[model samples]
Target: MNVHITLAHPEPTSFNGSLTYRAETYFKRAGNNVTKTDLYASDFDPVERGAHYKDRSNKDVFIPLGEQRAAWKNGTTPEDVRSEIDNLRNADLVILQFPLWWHGPPAILKGWFDRTFPSGGVYTSRMRYDEGYFKGKRAMLSVTTGAPEEAFGPGARGGDPATMLWPLHYSLHYLGFEVLHPFLAHGVQGHGYSYEDHGKAECRLAQKLDSWEDRLAGVWNEAAQSFPGWPDWDHRGQPLS
Candidate 1:
């Protein structure tokens, strides 16, 4: 399978980076072609500018200002962002690897979505509220969190990690990607914890990669099950059942 892994953490030696490296290694070892997009290393621009839309044919093309404004407030769009979008368009699976910063993805990764997922980019405005681009793709999040898993449970340091992930889940699902259970590594900041520990965490991560490899190689049955019909709403907010 052709896979693309996008890493957003800045530190090369950080736990997030370590997981990305391991994931890439495992994917390749499984005989899959893997492409890596390190956001920070690539210096991806995160802000959107007027130029992106300045060339619109009509001054009143009915661009969704609310959505465009939201993206701009986050960051500027990178010049080479289209290449990343194209990668997603062609990939069999996409893995987003990042650190849990303030209970969300790092800004760079979020910016990636802002630019790559707008109308006329990946999904069109008419299809935004229905099934859209990326209709048959598969995606997963590989995250490293500094806090313990308990801290993210109900009524703890925050709420459930799954709750915090709703937007991400809905976004990918709306774009027609089959969502996989995330691979999360919690307690990275615990006492004596290190990315190179070569201990239980590493072993567990390896096991997770093995499972992920198997899943990626499997036929995309979930996509058909979730979207039994085309252009209709499924439980995941897209068309299927």
Candidate 2:
């Protein structure tokens, strides 16, 4: 199987970095061809603007959706966008690795979605949801948080993980990727602010890394997390009751 892992953290020596390294080694050992995209190391620009559209449909106006559609149709899409899309096309599984910041993924990853998934080429109004472009592929998020696991719950201190991750997960669903349940690493702090002793915290973090490896061993056979599809909605996009 072919796999692609996209890492969005800035620090190469960080825990997020280690997890990516671990995945690269593990996937290769499992006989899967793996491709990696380190956003910071590669200097991926997170901004979407007129500058990216070299051969614009309308020179005076900068409508992102319009420009993307036109560029794709004209074979003038940005080089970076084209390359990322190519990587995605060749992969059977995609792993998005990052440290949760401001309750979501980094800006670069967000921009990756905005740019790489071209409007006219990859998705259309009637071609989305269950019938999306990358239908048979699978995707998952591996995220780290600085707060302890116990601090997270409904109305808890660290906020609800499910709710926080909904948008990112839904976006994958939009692309027709069967999204696996996310792998979360909690209480991951660069400093000693995670409310745990040094030795215990290190041990716990190590355990989490090991568990991640174990989890991925059978992830391909695991069921994709269910989400509402076109069959569940009506013409007005309301839930069928």
Candidate 3:
């Protein structure tokens, strides 16, 4: 399969960085084409402001969604946003590799969603949800967390993984990706806060890398995470009665 890996961490030597590298190497070795979008290395600008739209529809009033729609129609999309869109268009499977910061994706990745997913270009009101632009493609997250596994549960201190991940997963569903179960690596503390010796952490990380490879081997056969779509919603956007 053609795969695209988007890395959000600033440091290329970080755990999240290693995960993206491993994914690229594993897939390519398996004879699949892989593309890497290292957001930091590429110096991706995360903030979306009025300046991005040079051909603004209303220069005085900067409406984000309106500007995006206009930019897409005029083919005046910023080079960075255009590049990401192109990569996603060609990929069969898209993997987002990042560390969980404050229970969500980094500013870079979130801004990626904000900029790359042009309102009129990638999706429309009627063409969203299950019927989104990337209907046939697959997407999943490979995340790292600083907390231990025991800390995450329905009512744990680290917060429920499922609940924390819902907004992002739902966003993918909105764009028509067949979202898969996220691959999480817990107990991944940074240098100063590391709970284990350096050697032990390296060993654990190596083992996790192996597990990631195994997951990829069966990715195609895996069931996607189910989400409610138009069929399940009413005129008021509530669940159908």
Candidate 4:
């Protein structure tokens, strides 16, 4: 299978980056074609503005969606975005590896969603949800958290994992991917941030890496997380009774 891993951590030696590397190696060892994009290492611009669009559809106002539509139509989509899109186009499974910062993804990864999935090129009103362009593709999030696993759940201190991850999972669903249950590694404190003994923390993290590899072996056969599709919603997007 073709796999694409997108790493959104700033430090290449970070635990999040290690997960990305492990995934790449796993796929390659299995004889699958693996590709990767390290957003920080590549210095990917996460901001979307008029600067990205060379040939503007409207010079007076810079509407992001409008410019995207025009660019896709005129074949003037920014080269970097186009390249990222091409990577997605070739992948059977797309893994997003990132740390949970401020209870959400890093700005760079979010911007990848903004730039890579062009308006007219990837989605339209009629082409979203179950009918989105990437209908047959699969996507998963491998998230790392600083708090312990016990701190996350409904009514927990770190906030519920389901609630924290909903926006991202829904966004992938919007693009028509079969979104998998996220793989979460908690207690991922960096130096000087440990809640427990440093030696114990290191040992736990090492075990988590092994667990990650084991999970990947059967990732394809796992059922995707349940999500409301077109059939579940009315024309107004409310849940059907």
Candidate 5:
């Protein structure tokens, strides 16, 4: 199967990078084709602005969605966004690898969501949720945190992973991919930021990498996270059950 991995971390040698590398190796070793997009390395611009569109629907104002719709309709989408969308289209599985900064994904990755998923192209009023363009594909997040796993969850210092990741997961679900449970690596600090002995930190992180590999082996068979689809929502977009 074709697999696409998008890495959003800046440091190539960081643990976040390791998770991405490990995933690529795992998929490739299994004889699957792997495609990687290192957002930083490629210098992906995450900001949405009128600069990207030359023939604007309204030059006097910068309406992000309006320009996106026009671009999709006119085949004038920025080359980078078009390329990324094509990569997504050709993949069976997509892995989003990033570090949790300020309780969210990096700005670049967020921008990728903004630009790549074009209006009228990937989704329309009638093509969202269960009917999204990537309906048959799968997507998952490989996220790392500097705090210990114990520090997360309800009433925890680090905040609940579910709450932190809901927006991203929902966005993927919006695009029609089956969203898998995230592979979370907690206590993932650099040598300088580590609270424990450097050796102990290294040992723990290494183990997390092992766990990630094991998880990936069963990723395809793992059940997807539950989200409200079209059938589960009413005309007013309220949950039916």
Candidate 6:
């Protein structure tokens, strides 16, 4: 399987970076083809400009977005964004590794979505709504949190992680991907957790990955059964399929 791992942390030696490294190693060791996108190290542009709007009607309008996303799936896109897109497009699974800063993905990763997920870039006009270009893909989040797990519960100070994660879950679900439960390492930076704690964290993360790997693959295969079209339903209506 082709798995794309996108890292969003800015610091090279941070715990988030270490998690990404371990994830890559694990996936590769599992016999899957792994591609890593270090958004910060790549100096990716996070700002969208007038050019993005100017070429809307041009025949090559989708070119830039396509180039930016080329590497995502399997190197099928052209040399530009194609690498990133190919990585996304051809992957059997996509693992997003990042720190839960301010309760969401870092700016650059968010920018990646903004730049890549255009109306015609990934999803064609007809395929909008329930159907998306990335339909049938499987995605998982591996995040590191500075706060302890206790702070993320239903009645805790930080509130439920599920609530904090709704945007990401809904986005993937809207794009027709299956959302797996996130793997979170809490209290990584807090007092009492020593350097040796990282080893335990790694083991926990590995166990989570091992437990979900087959289930995620199953979800991807199931997602592929649907046509690339919106179902006959509304927000208040029941799911058609």
Q: How many residue pairs clash in each candidate?
A: 12, 0, 0, 0, 0, 30
Alpha-carbon lDDT, every model? 0.68, 0.89, 0.90, 0.91, 0.91, 0.65
Tens digits of per-residue lDDT, candidate 3, 52-133, equal: 9888999999999999999999999998999999999999999999889999999999988888898999899899999999
TM per prediction:
0.73, 0.97, 0.97, 0.97, 0.97, 0.71
Task: Using lDDT as the measure, name the better of candidate 3 and candidate 5.
Answer: 5
* Of 2 and 4, the candidate ranking higher by lDDT: 4
Which model is ahead, 3 or 6, in terms of lDDT?
3
**Tens-digit lDDT track of model 2 for 108-151:** 88988877888989999987879999999999999999888998
Q: Which residue pairs does candidate 3 place in steric collision?
A: none
Return the clash pairs for model 2, or none. none
- Model 3 spans > 4 angstroms off: 191-193
Instruction: Encode model 6's per-residue lDDT on 1-241: one tens digit a residue.
Output: 8888888887877766766766677667777888989989988776654353422433454555543333233333323255677788888788888778888888897777666554445665455535666766778777777776777888788768887877876666566665667777776653313234767755765564554444444533543222223456545555666
What C-alpha root-mean-square deviation, in Å, does candidate 5 show against the real structure?
1.2
Candidate 2 segments whose C-alpha is farther than 4 A from its true place: 191-195
Q: Ten residues in a row with the worst lDDT in model 6? A: 71-80
lDDT tens readout by residue for model 5, 1-241: 9999999988898998888889999999999999999999999999999999989999998999999999999999999999999899999999999989999999999999988998899999989888989998999999988888889998889999999999999999999999999999888877313567788888888888899999999988999998988899889999897
Among all windows of 10 consecutive residues in model 1, the one with the lowest summed lDDT is 220-229
Question: Where does candidate 1 stray beyond 4 Å?
Answer: 51-79, 126-130, 190-241
**How many clashes in candidate 5?**
0
lDDT of 4 by residue, 1-241 (tens): 9999999999888898778888999989999999999999999999999999998999999999999999999999999999989999999999999999999999999998888888889999989988988999999999999998989999889999899999999999999999999999998877413477988877888888899999999988999998888899999999999
Q: What root-mean-square deviation over C-alphas does model 3 reach?
A: 1.3
